[model samples]
Target: MTAKAERMASLPSSLPPFGVGRLKAAALFDISPSLFDRLVESRQLPQPRLLGGRLVWDVSELGDAWRSLPHRLEDIDGFTTTGNPWDE
Candidate 1:
């Protein structure tokens, strides 16, 4: 194989394409398609954009939305729970 072919073969194959369909978008988030739809409806995720007459999710937008999701308090650093509220 030529050097260019070798370099191309060495590139990561699992990287997502620029834009993806509904199913692919769901798979990217590791969630069911229905749940993906619910998230979209709830405005937790951005709506897909029209590309070449096809509705497709932009991977960068998905990434931004994922980063914007709320994180649990426990997941945050310097967080501590005093007493269990359930005990009150």
Candidate 2:
């Protein structure tokens, strides 16, 4: 690969809302589509824009949400953390 190609490959994939699908989002988060539905129902997830009858989420906003999930630790038995990493 050329230097430019290698550089691009090393960078994170930036997917705009128009290109993102619900299934792709769920897969990336290791969750089910039902969970995504709940997030949407509860308004926790980013509002999907209607583009040609397809629902999509903004990657930048979704990235922020993914980070917030770890921070908002509730009562999930599987997730183990010190509650707040900055609470030390």
Candidate 3:
């Protein structure tokens, strides 16, 4: 299996692959629910699915998204100011 899949499979059952809400995601990131939606809209975070009007995301995707934050910000900064941060 892929690394993400393997890691996801090993997470505690309390956090399954999907079906998470803004409240739970906020708790995971220690942010407010409203802020979480803003982050999502800004593309600073992953966009979860909607189930019956409830926003949800897989724990695995959330974990990956969390880990990618720094990289994403770096890329944005590089693109905006340097044309390419890794162009050294």
Give the number of the best model, judged by lDDT. 1
Give the range of the ten consecutive residues with the poorest summed lDDT in model 2. Answer: 70-79
Off by over 4 Å in 3: 1-17, 71-88
Native RMSD of candidate 3 (Å): 10.0
Model 2: residues >4 Å from true position, as ranges? 1-18, 72-88
* lDDT tens digits by residue: candidate 1, 33-72: 9999999999889899998898899999999988876565
Residue 84 of model 3 has an lDDT of 55
Q: Order of all candidates by TM-score, from best down to worst? A: 1, 3, 2
Which candidate order results from sorting by lDDT in descending order?
1, 3, 2
- What is the lDDT, from 0 to 100, of the residue 61 in candidate 3? 81
What would you estimate as the lDDT of candidate 1? Answer: 0.84
**Model 2 C-alpha lDDT per residue in residues 27-56, reported as the tens digit of each score:** 767789999889878988777777788887
Model 1: number of backbone collisions = 0
What TM-score, over all chains together, does every model reach?
0.63, 0.56, 0.56
Is candidate 1 or 2 superior in TM-score? Answer: 1
Off by over 4 Å in 1: 1-16, 74-88
Clashes of each: 0, 0, 1
Residue pairs that clash (backbone atoms under 3 angstroms), model 2? none
